[model samples]
Target: MSSAADSNSDGRRNRGMLKSYYTQGENSGDKQFDLDDSSFKPDQYLDFLLKKSSLNELMHQEEEIVQNIRSLDSEMQTLVYENYNKFITATETIRKMKSDFGQMEEEMKALSENMDNICDLSSSVSDTLQQKRSGIRKLAGVHTLLQKLQFLFELPARLKKCIEMEAYNQAVRYYTRARAVLNQYQHMPTFAGISQDCGSIIYELGNALKEKLRDSEASSKQLAEYVDLLLQLEEPADSLCDEYLISARSRVDEKVQELEDVLEDNSVDILEFVDIGCNGVLSNVSLLVVAYNDMFLNRAKANTELDSIALQKVSALVKEILHKFFELIQKRVQLEKQTGDNAILVRALDRFHRRLQAMNKLLPTAELATLATEIVYNAAKDRIDHYYQALTDHLGHCITDIRQALAAPKLISSNLDENSSTPLQNLVQTSVSSLVEQIKAVLANLQAFIATDITFAMKSTFRRPFCFDGVREGLVVRFLRRMLEYLNELCEKPSGPATLLLLLSKLATILEESTIGYLLVLVDEQFLIVQEGDVQFTNPQTLKDEAKAAAKKLLNNYVRLEGQTLSHMVRKSVETRDWLNTIEPRNVRAVMKRVVEDTSSIDSQVGQLYDDMEEQKKDRGSDSTKRSASGLMKSSKTWSFTPSTTAAVLDNSAFMTNISKLFSDKIDIFSEVDASRASIMTGIIKIVLKTLLECVRLRTFSKYGLQQVQVDTHYLQMYLWRFVQDENLVHRLLDEIVSSSLHRCIEPSLMENSVIELICERG
Candidate 1:
């Protein structure tokens, strides 16, 4: 009900405002009435109008509203009539255009059918014409291709005719052209038949040329033709030509065989027979090279521009000759292995070496020259080896005799028995001097063969059984080393026999080298010793005893090695056979002095250790005391306290273990000695006694400590007895042992001091 009333009120307010707008009279304030509060109260508005105006105002406003309504309704009707006429005219025009479009489409449909009929006729006629034109063009292309490739079609037949006519040059031309075509079209099946035919022809050509090369009685011109044909073939022909030359080398075998027969008869001179055999082989090889070169002079000149294939071919032939030559010599030389007959055989070998050296100069190729060099070297080396073998055999029993003499001190005399005609004396002075001259001659020839540089020359050649690996020194150097090694063993055995020493000195004089001196240096360098840092020992007394004994034996061996052996060798020098002329004994004494100095160094080290332990003990102080009573004792003393005080072992100082280590380390220092001779042994004993005394003064010890020292002294004494067993030496050593043990560790009474003094003076 309120909504209906409000609608009626809005309608009344709108109508009144409309009536005021149309009837615009008098009050201009009524034109701007407030409509913001649109909640219209019609009765209130009517009352406001009634209070402001009369009924004439109301009638006049209603008549103006009717006039404005009539004017708006007429204008709206005119606008609708105009738009409706335009709509009728447009509809009529559209209907007329639709009829014309339908007629045009009907005419287009008929025209399209007519054109379709024309197109069908044109398509049929064009297909026939295009087929004819394609056929004509294909025929033309076939005719043109055949004309362009007419040479390819005739190439196989032309090649066959040329080969049949023995026109090899013409055939090669056709084959070369055919190969070019095949290379261009090889992937296509059309060329396969002709390519196979070409391959067959080439194979036939090669076989024919090989047959010509195989002909034994062929002249140089005939051989040259085959060589030229093979070169024209220009596939890798080195191996093929190598085989042909090897066949040519068969002639040398016949010559060598004849020489072998002559060599076997023994009536023929061996050197003359070898010369005949080698010259025949060299002449045949030279002829073979000349024949090969004459046959292909032009081709050879051309190929020489790249590599000397001709030289390679001829060098291969030369190698074949050398092969046969070595085989013959090696067989004959192998049959005669008697050292007594080595000189004649070696002389024959030297002749062969000379002939090979001449041949080496004649050869043009480096390969051939290298081959000749190898042949010469082998010959020279065989001679040298044979000569040395004879020398070694001659000296064998002498070496054994000398070794037996060296085994005992008085078995062999150091001076020559001038009145004696023993085999050893004869072998050393006579046989040995002659052998040294022979060896020198052989080595000189060898040095010449290798051109004074064996390593560089022989490195690119061959190595024989006696060759030293990585040796820069020549064959003589190695041979000298080997010979000296064998002789040094013979002569240096326990003051080597004087004759052997004399032979060594003679060899050194002959070679103008310090032969024995260098051998001594090699011995010294090879002197295997326990590196001082590597000599280890344990705390166990037995193990330390074993270590000390082994070390003593090694030191004695070193002493004997340097003193008796090396000193005797140097003393045997012609200028130094006696004390007045010799410094060897003095050198030995100097070595002994150096050994004493080394022991003195050990004494100083123990003294330093003594002071260090004193310092460490002071630092170990009351803390060490609270832990164990053994802390107050020296390291060597605590071990004597037994298993009952094992906990105190750790608290004991490490001084004694360090001393044991020092003892082991000091033992190695004597390994510098090669031998302990009579004088060397006495010097060593004095050093050991002084060292023991130093140990005594350096530390305060319990009974066990003194016992350890005594045991060590006894072990050293026992080792020394093996080299020196003098009773006075043993007695004096034992006296020091007892006095040091008693006066130093056991009891130091005033009365015993005199006894100690007497023992010390006796020592």
Candidate 2:
């Protein structure tokens, strides 16, 4: 009603605007004519008094009339053009109605004349029959009675034929027509026998119909006819209605099951699959309710008292069948996790609801159409929500599956590519590639659905376009947080070996340099959510930058990781020696050679990883190396960078005393390194070398042990010289290692730099 009123008001307002435009020339209210006023009175426009106005004014009025006539014609044409289709339909309807009415009039007149003639004939016949009325009535009664008796005698045979031919309707009509006559003449044995035979045939027919209804495979149309036949047999309305509803519900159930079990095989087109379920359920169930209505509800509607329990049962089953079908739809939505044309899917659901609504023409009170629509719509809405959640879950699942794969034991080293020399190399290869592959797969999958934003129109205000952007942001945060946390964990307690820690650090770098930027490209292209002056969420560009910082942090962790492993090797070498009875140091000890070689390898791996970050850096450590191949000179220059957290984990008293003795006076040692890979790695070497000095201080050494320490320091200083920015820093750290060993040695003879350099060089 409100909508109707609104439309009427809009029409009136439009009409008034057209009226105002039409009357703009006629400014005077008294002379104004309504646009809809079709009558034109020339007398009103004509000035009868010849001297009332000047000739020029009369000529001007004539021009105005001509202009008004042209304006009216234009307006008429425009209105007709707009309403052309309506005008054509109205003309066609008028013509059709005239033709039909005229034809009906002629037929009515002809029938009237025929009725008059028939009346005359009937009166004449009645006059003639009045004298012989008794004779005619007696003869007619005898003929009718004989006809009924003949039909009764033939009733049994006709019913048998009907059963054989499956013409149950014809048989019922034949039996009903003879029932009263048979009952009236039942005293005669012959009539009684005929009635008995007809009754037996009908009993068999009723059994046959009930059996058909019980058959689960019976088609919908067959079920309808079967119920109809039983109802004609005067089957109890309560039982019959109950049976019909049960059978209909079963048929609906089968279709629902078929949709769940078969249609979702995923080979069919989605729209076709949805349509199959809709048509199958709708057409079959329409037959259910329609046939039920005809047999039972129609009678109840006609004011006949039916069992209320039957009515309620019918209502409950209808609701049940609908709910079951809707549950199937819900399951399908949930199971269809793959993102597709959501518009088509949602529209298909709506089409299904519309088809269900067609059943309202048969059963209006159930409102299953409206109910089903809500269920299917919510399913679609929830499916979208799940799409966003699936992205987050996908990231998490990737991490989890990777962890499980790493946890699985890999004893067969040969299975790793032929290039892999050992199990650790294989671990590095698989771990790094798996993480990269997982992230790449996630981004690729994200690309599929994030751009195709599905619209949700039911809201009163605008909704954000499918907040997959938020999901993308979550992927960034989760990948960073989870990956960094795992990296930190590995650095702290490397699960396999130190190689695993380096691999994780490499993975973190990939995230910072490549993967995070990829994610941001996808996120930034969507809605301009962060207005210039408004508050913002975690902006993707900012996140892209932060990932770089995280990469550096992981590198520092890598430093601590290698430092621990190398420091352990130093301790084991010192612990295994018999310093009291040891022979003279020949060249450098194997442990020192291995440590020097591994340090060079570490430098190359870490430097190459971040080489591009600083293209042509001046090697400050190389300057110190050029000063003397002998070793780093003890300098009073303050230590330029703070040691990593590895240093903080140990007590400073022994380590502090070692540092104080190595320098002439204690130099300030706490300084921060830049978060570049080179700076970070230089800090790692300084800390690890200092750790080596601390390990030396922990042991007691004889003369050869002290010489071995000096040889190791010279070789390390020579090779590690080219790796760090502040060359003096590495010199000071290796010098401190020798100084600390001398302090602990029982016999303090040290190898000269010339001798140590020649032995390291020649070997």
Candidate 3:
């Protein structure tokens, strides 16, 4: 029993210890029982169990938990501090890199500024150097001009002495040398201020030298000396003075009077001096007076001695000077001929020609007219002849050059091959073409001038009818016909584009007035010939009858040609892309109207002639009819007047039927053409609309006075409704009419009526 008690107590003690251990670990019974529950709330159980533990023990345990928490917090703080240091280091490095980039950008900007400064300085230096070089060049040119002027300054004195000594050759040589120096100086690139003064001095010196020589010729006692002086002065004076200088007439007259006094006294032993001086003075005075009568008052004396010995001397001198001038001209012409580049020579020739023309202009009024006409005629004839000669010469030269080029051995193969497409060949072709065009142009101009002049001349000279007598109408008609024929020929020529169109335009102008009449006559004639047979003259009448017949024939031909020509034009217009829209229908209508008028006129004339014939028959009375009937009976066996019963004649001879047929054919052609010209059909329709509207307007106006407020609105509406059925056309027509009415500011009622009428007519 004792042993059983001991075992039970041990078991009880073990259970208590186990229970205590579990209870210390878990405060709640549920927690103590849940040993397998890993998600149990230990903190909540520990707090509950701490309230039951010893204070010292609990305090120690609490200290240990607090220490653990503090250690974890310190570790976390160290890690955070290390991460912050890394972030700070990265930010510092980024700032340092940015600083470096900023420094580099500033350095680059400074370097760029330095480069710009350097370039600017270089450009400034270059500009300065160029300016200096230009200055140096200008200085050099000034020095050269000064040197030339120095050389020219010594010329006048030498020329004066030569003239006094009558050494013409020496005078000319000096003058030429001075002129050459002056020319060289003029061309030098010096300061204009310096050159202008020098040029004036040189011109004055040249003029003075020439004047001295001219004076020596006019007053010198030695004949040989005088002639030499005059010859020396002639060319230079003429060249320098041209027509600008007024000759020293007072000095010349004084010298002449002194010589005459000496001749009368017979005390002067120098007979040659008196004779030569007197003659020279008189001749020069005469020439001067003739050239400048406004300056000289010695015309009466001049004219008195004009046929005397003094005049003969003057004439001889004049002839001599002219000969020299012509010789110089011939020499220049020869030089030009040799050089081929003759621009300078041509200019010189033109200058002289202009001087002659000016001289001709200065003649007396009545004499001037005759002189001018003669001169113009002669000059024009000469120029025309010269042009022909020049053309011949140039052609000959070209042929020679071509032959030479062809014969050259080196050019044999190449020439033959390239000649087929050579520039020379092209140039020749171009020249020929150009020449042909120029000839046509000239001929056309001549034709116009001649047409105008001849018309005027005929009117003036043939006022009394010289050749045609009373047949002036025939003469004028023939002239017009010839002119038309000439124009037609010109139009036929294949001139180049510009010239051909110009020629056509010119021809149109030249024939404008005559053409209207001619066209009318032509249309009439063509219609007549095509409708009726050729005109048949049964009996010859007077000259008037012949003239009338001829005029009728001409009219017929003109009308026929006009119709044919118009037909061609119409066809061409239709074939064009934008035909009727581009063409002015008014023009076509005008031409058609002309043709119609012409035909109607001819018909009226024929009717008049028929009436005249009937009148003549009546004048002859019943006897004449009886004779006519008897004669008809006698010739009945031979001429049975049995007109072929083929077509029904509307009139006695079917003339009206034929005329209708001809017009019908033309209208048919026009309609076909219009049908083909689709693009222009709209334009044609518009024109038709306009015409119908106009007709309606005219009819309305004629029927109703201007003040009539009441218009036939229903009639207009009906017409518009019938004419304008297409919706698009109706809208277009309405818009056009409205816009036109707005522009014209027409009364709304009137415009509305017109539009309605147009629309109805169109429908």
Candidate 4:
């Protein structure tokens, strides 16, 4: 009570001290600090602060003041830390500006001197040329007249020389200038002959220009130059433009056909194919677009422009040619549907994407350039989808293979030692290595894909989720979901005991031991790492927990299947017999030997298989095995899946029902899987014996048949002791079978206990 009173009193003192440091302002609930309180006409603000407050309160106020000072100091330091680089940059900029001002002053003085020198030189030159200007002007006219006469006399010969030199551009310039003068005086004999000769040579130059335009080997610049010359010659571009466009179309076609031929060449691998696309087809088509644009769309400054009608025609053709070229680029770069193992095409798609980026940059104004880039980006997405689809199909095939293997009769010629290898072990390891190899190849390809830098302008527009956080998480999720789907297909029908358990062991071991670690390496080293320093791509431990749970569920499923198979065997043995008519029990029936022999096989397969089923529990931080599972596999080095709740991973209810029918007890089947193999085996053995007892109670046994039942029960009891350490469950089950047999016996006779033990031992 005193502490609470002291705390309240301290709070009041602190508030009084705070208000004392500054004048009292208006209350917040009223008009706030708007009241004129700056005049220091305050009343009892400090009446209790200095005169009545204790030394402890004063000391407390001083500590808070010191703390505020420290806080302010910390804030000042934070400001400096945040803006230190900017402060240093500002200092350097100021220094540089000062130095630049000094240089500017000197440059201004030099500029002023140069201007004065230019004024003086201009004055002297003007004085020097003043007297001779009239005479020089008069001679310029005479000089022009004489030069024209000389050019007319030499025009035909010069035109001939130009034709031999293939200087059509120069020839056209010369002939067009001369034609005006020749026509002015064509009535005179000399002028008319010059005009006639020039016309014929000009005709030949026109023909050369047309031929040059058609030449597919002509460079873009050469084509533009030829088109310009023809335009200046007043050649009607309507038909000529059509021909030119056709020639451009033919060149693009040739490049596309060449690419097609390369595609048809099976000997050329994907990398080579991508190379041809970038260098040969991609470059050629872009060049054709550029050349066509230059010739038809670009207006030359000095040459006569094409008429509006002709330009519209040419523009339409240009659009057609450009659209076709882009279409070709789009169709060619699109990757085909391939299996997941073939995701190396991602690298090839990246190469094409880069080339398309160059194309867009080369012709940034063309709508086609941007469209082509977008198309290629979508193609990349489609390729990734196809790769995943292929992987799904590949996994489906693997599941099918397991189904076929399970359908065959299971045989184990020998017992499996934990340290020794078996076909099942080898097969599981090989499958894991095969999958990891596919993932490694995919990682390699996608690494190259992400390494490709898109242009800043395209980056926002073309950004894909391919590299967000790490692609590993999404990929792993999809992969695990599909695999779970395949596993569920087996669960839909009742498969044999070995089938699901073998698959569960193989898959769970690979997932926890090999796959999860590979994913970590893939994200950390090979793929994009998130900068936030969080393992959001996937948390290793949480995923491990989930995997552990899933493996437990599979174990329960296998456990239930084991019980069903054993019970089935018992039912078959009991149902096939004619218990009412039989000979004296000869050396315990073959059914008991079959039962024990089958049980021994179970011991060997399950003991080894469950050791495998107990997968991933062992910190196999030691990944033991690697093998190649495909002809396409390069080597053993690279290798490269479920769920929560009851979706598919846990088959709790149905399994529980089947188990309840067998055991007649409310056993938590799921809880039992965590115990030793002996407990589980004992539970299943007791279930099978109980089934035998149930079969005995249904029948009326003859005295010999009763003896047969006694022998088989004793035989099962003695031999099965090797499997179950706890004989209590086995004893209860076997004893019940004898009592039921005695009750069902028509003669009501019984074999001696020692007689029964000796008969079972003799077998």
Q: Quantify how close model 1 is to the true structure by its C-alpha RMSD in Å.
A: 29.9
Candidates 2 and 3 compared: the better one by TM-score is 2
lDDT of 3 by residue, 7-73 (tens): 4456556766676677676665575334234345767768765877788988897798799779756
lDDT of 4 by residue, 1-763 (tens): 3444454456556755666456446453322222222333333434445786788997997688699779756665555565666667999999999999999999999999999999999999989999999999999989999999999989999999998999887888898888778989999998999889888888888898899889989866777688778877878766767767667667666766776776656456565677876676667657755665565556564233554544555446545654654454445445345343334455555566667667665454545455655665566556566556656777766656665665555434335555655555455666667766776666665554555453421353443345542245556556655565555455455455554464565477567655876666675565445545443445666565555556555655665676677778888888889988988775887777877876776656556544532433242334322211121111211211022432321133235434535775432322445434554566567667777988888988987887788778778877775565345456556656765675676664455556666777778
Error of 2 at 239 (Å): 3.4
| Shift in Å, residue 150, candidate 2 | 15
* True lDDT of residue 103, candidate 4: 100
Candidate 1 wrongly placed segments (more than 4 Å): 1-250, 256-269, 298-315, 330-363, 386-396, 404-555, 558-678, 681-732, 737-763
Best by TM-score: 4
lDDT of 2: 0.62
lDDT of 3: 0.37
Q: Write out the backbone clash pairs for model 2.
A: 620-727, 621-727, 642-671
| Candidate with more favorable, higher TM-score: 3 or 4 | 4
In model 1, how many backbone clashes occur? 12
Question: Which lDDT tens digits does candidate 2 get at residues 439-495?
Answer: 555455434222333222222122232232333444545555655565555555645
Better of 3 and 4 by lDDT: 4
Candidate 4 global TM-score: 0.54
For each candidate in turn, the TM-score is: 0.34, 0.52, 0.18, 0.54
